[model samples]
Target: MINWHRLFGLALEDYFTGTRYAVEMEKDVARKRQVLDVVIVRGTGEALVDPCDGLEDLRPHNLLTYKSGQESLDAWAIEELIGHYVNYRKAFAPREPAARFGLYAVTTRRPRALAEQVTLTPVKPGVYRLPVVGRSITLIVLREVEPCPRNALWEIFSFEAAKVAAGAGMYQWRQDDHFPILEEIYRRYREAGIPMSYTFQDFRRDLARETLPELTPEERLRGLPPEDRLRGLPPEDLVRGLRTEGRLRGLSDEDVAQLKDLLERGTSRRQ
Candidate 1:
């Protein structure tokens, strides 16, 4: 088996740029960008940042959306990160050099706002890489930790590294303490020759739903309004009420034009 300890250290080394034997840096060091607790906009050759400024600003508005799930940090961290960048404004702007945020997470969810701007690909369970502009970021999921663990509160995803561009923390989540349980669940699945990426959140979801409910097509449509529904309606829904019941079976003029444009140019990459 590979040496997990050495590998862990190596990963950290890569994360911290190149830490020699892993002694924490007290202040920002130019070359050792690997171990920064946070990366602030520079001032007099130093670092200082407002953590709450980013994601916290967006929480009250629907600009930031989140849902509860099995893992604590996994359930919340990505949302918080989204809030952070949403707060950054220029962080994911239309024109910026490629840059990335180092992360530690217990789980991940689809980002709330920047989904269209960044191209995200899964690097590992609980880990992802988001390519924003030309720069790339490494994300890690974590769980909730508390002095009051019994209440099961799930908030809290920030860390020292978040203060810089490379914050990582040992965040606790719902199934974080149940490592043995997860290993066993995965082991049983694999032993039976079923392959799956088993995570703590996956185990918790299984534990929570004794019988999962199924959603049907009509049931799915119930939440959608005629305006929001994608039924090829056109004329900007102004003509919907007048003889528009099943009259507009085809796509809107805009949709057809968009399709034509796609066909003409095809999918091209940025230079």
Candidate 2:
């Protein structure tokens, strides 16, 4: 699986960099004699990062499981992740409340219906939650997430070596509309000295482009209103507004263009 244990550890270490918790991978559960994919423990480092968006605040401890896109997790998977939480509580956390450890399941595929007793709630577009006992288990659906530069999870799609091999067929959507963020993540991976696993070595040979071309300043300014553009304001802000706020307002591109042209002519005549 392209050394998922190493890849996730490297990525999450960076993701939670500066957080109070330390990121651990392939953690052993001596009770069940099983290994966990990842865990976050408090006091691992200095507290420096604000909480990441769409992710809950880090607790004293957290348990996580990761599945490649093709892997279909059933009720058993849920049971297993919860079991890790149970073990974590029994072993590590004592003075803390029951279920002090958080549980996380990150995958590209939508999980099958969970146990009837488990109530899944939507925390965000790509994040779901099940509060069991006194702790919370979060499900991160990678393919369901929208592209954003601010999302720390871009590493899952962009840089996870296992995904390059295991997820190509099923979770291709992970690469869609995320080229910019992906490039940033890839750069970090390279800078961090994390090597691509042998599983992906053959695949990287045929890899075409590393990143897509981002919109230039000229392109961003192209359709902006003369008043806004000539005001020497940030044209990218206008483009962002057009894409997000304007869409919400139901403003069509044609409508925006006509308004820009009208303003351009008005300003030209006055000059």
Candidate 3:
């Protein structure tokens, strides 16, 4: 079975790298094994370049509860989320204003039972604001969110094949070494019988396209073979920077004769 909770937390960690928020998974709110699914605390650093769909208005402290596709986001889940929020507040910031904290419930699907119990006001597409115990909670339905770059992380957990493909294509990891996490997600999807048309090779190509442009020419060609390094260059460009001896140094007499013949043939064809 897929460890959705842990995977989701790690994804969030990768998503928030270099941002002002710090993500902690399975946070211990009390000594009695009361653990919160995830907690995101505001810290000092660069702000998010592109915030997720339901997380536009982040507070100093945010508590999030996630329900995978296999699980139902029922009334008990919301109650537990609220209970965790209360415990966190009492223990960590009893004197802080309620406005300093935020509550979020992210689910792969809509919480029908929770919706029946309380009103979930539609704040935006796929996002709802629920009022409970005088506090507002943001409910993000991942499957309903529009497929876009900002919502790519949420789409990864949507468990729908199309959305997962879109997310895999659009989402750029903040850190360079998170490909293994993506591989695990793909493996779980396959295990669950989801037909993902987007293969791991597609992901690798997309990742290279996104990251390669930011690197210098030398940096990009660091470990490439000689032929690969000069793969796309025109003949003139291949020898443009080399001096006469530099170009001839590595050529044997037979190789030099073949090179001279090839150059003569090219010149004759052009003429």
Candidate 4:
């Protein structure tokens, strides 16, 4: 079952934070404060789902949900739902140009009181900030009545400042609000073109730029052919170089198998 509450927060979070940094800064000199807005704009993790294709499954009685087949709806599905509600509630919980989104629903599914003991206070309707995390994070608690196509949800928009004050190292991150599952979902959503998340092998493949090992006669005898230990200078040198090169190059599966076969046959042929 989809948690409409979690989904609501997620829909907006993924749009702003899940993508790369979206921010601009301004100083509140009078209050001796600095403010930043991570605005939503075209970037890597962006999409354009029409207000129509998004909300076919919402219903009023349900407080938090997106049922079976509909749950298959991916990240953009959630964002689209949020967008729909924002448009629907234009008169009520209208979008905040400063933050550029909206949300409205019971607070049951809101993020658990951040274990960090942080609390958010609405400076006014629809704007919230906490005393923790350098007070850089903020939630725009949306409060308006509107029809959302994702019937199971009441929408909410989230805006957070990623930039921390000078020297506030750890205080500036966009806290996940303890939702790794949704974090991954949006990760996949942002990478919609790719069907799968990156794996260790994928990482190795992507970073295939390491330095190659040095080749030497004794090293070849130690690594590839113990029997070739007694070979002459150039003979030993060539064998060692090729074996070290193979290892350094990150041999493919077929290459390794063929290598073992050649090794089993012995290095006499290479000589």
Candidate 5:
């Protein structure tokens, strides 16, 4: 089985790279093996260049609980998230105001059980505000989020094949090294018998195509051999912008003679 929780945590870490937030997975809130799913704490960096869908209002400390498509986001999950928050607050910053912390529950599917019990006020398309114990919790339904570049990270975890494919195409990883995580995600989806039309090879080629335009000509041709650099060009195209002397400079005597004869034959045919 795929470790969805760990993968999601790693993806969050990748998404928040270069931002002022540091993402910690399975954080120990207390000494008795009680761990929180994810914790985003204040760190050193600039703000996010493109904020995610439900994380626009990040506080100094953010606690997130995630439920995969197979998992149930029932009342116990909410209680667990709150329990982690309370313990984290007491252990780290007991005197800090509650406003300094943010609580979030991210699920791949709608939490019908929880919604039936408490009111989930719709804040936006996929975002909801849940009032519990005098604090508002942000409930983000991944599958329902707007399908755009900014929400691609959330869409990848939505468990819908189409959304996952779209998300992979739209997401631009902050760090190039994080590509392995994407590959692993693809492998997991295949392992779980999910029929994804977007293959890993397709994602790789598309990613290369998207980023290649940002490179300079020299950078693009950096590791190419001389033959490979001119592999597909026709003889005419190869010599198009060059003067006669420049074109013949690198040609062997036999090659030059062959080119001259070929040109003469072509000219005779045209005449």
Candidate 6:
């Protein structure tokens, strides 16, 4: 199962490096009995250059909710987020010029019906804008977004889904091309001083733990006289070991037959 909350929170922090933003993960407002997925506030200090264009408006206070690909973000969810905004203001009431607020909803599934009802504007392929009273909320559908290595958000959001589809199993680790790509993505974040949790070390560890130990075929098992390597072993044990070694080496039927013939001849000679 996907940990949408953690993924979103970590990804946001990885993308926005430095002291420019104060990020609160799973922040709770007691009166509302609601725990926000992620809350980002712009730092009062020097402003940093926006990494992705058009995201400059995400300053002050951004209320973000992440939905897994399996989850749906409907009209009700949207209304609930608006409610969160109201609850947020009540909890942290600003003095004179209140902090600017923006809502952001991110998901991996398509929000067809929801999009129809709201004033949704396309910022990019998978990214949409829903017009609110004061500011617009950004809705990002990960499935609809184009794959760009340079786009940290896209890489982070799409990583798991892609990995599963690619069959990134331990035995098939070499076959998976995404592993390297994911490693590079993490490297970029580390370079910017934001070390993410879903790192290359974690990837390697998982692969190592899950994969069964493999053994190379014994050199004597590969050649002309199979008895040279099979001496002193019981008949059943030798046969079992040979079968396993053969399977691992992907030996053809003919090769097995040749080994069996050699074994039988050696047995007759011994008798």
* TM-score result, candidate 6: 0.55
lDDT of 3 by residue, 17-92 (tens): 9989999999999879888989999999999876888999999999999999989998889899999998999999
TM-scores for candidates 1 onward, in order: 0.21, 0.53, 0.82, 0.19, 0.82, 0.55
Span of 10 residues, lowest total lDDT, candidate 5: 171-180
Give all candidates' CA lDDT scores: 0.34, 0.61, 0.91, 0.33, 0.91, 0.64
* Candidate 3: C-alpha lDDT: 0.91
Q: Write candidate 6's Cα lDDT for 132-213 as tens digits.
A: 6665678887667655433435545443534322222221321334455546555544554553655567767776565424
Off by over 4 Å in 4: 13-124, 144-271
Q: Model 3, residue 2: what's the lDDT?
A: 43
Candidate 2, superposed: residue stretches over 4 Å from native: 44-53, 113-119, 133-135, 158-271
* lDDT assessment of candidate 1: 0.34
Worst 10 residues of 2 by lDDT: 167-176
Q: Total clashing residue pairs per candidate? A: 30, 0, 0, 9, 0, 0
True lDDT of residue 104, candidate 2: 79
In the range 220-260, model 1's lDDT, one tens digit per residue, is 57868876776776666756565744554577989777877
Stretches > 4 Å off in candidate 6? 44-54, 96-99, 133-135, 159-271
- Candidate 4 residue-wise lDDT, 163-198, digit = tens: 111111111124445245334433433343323343
The superposed Cα distance between candidate 3 and the true structure at residue 241, in angstroms, equals: 5.6
**Model 1 stretches astray by more than 4 angstroms:** 1-26, 29-110, 143-271
| Clash number for candidate 3 | 0
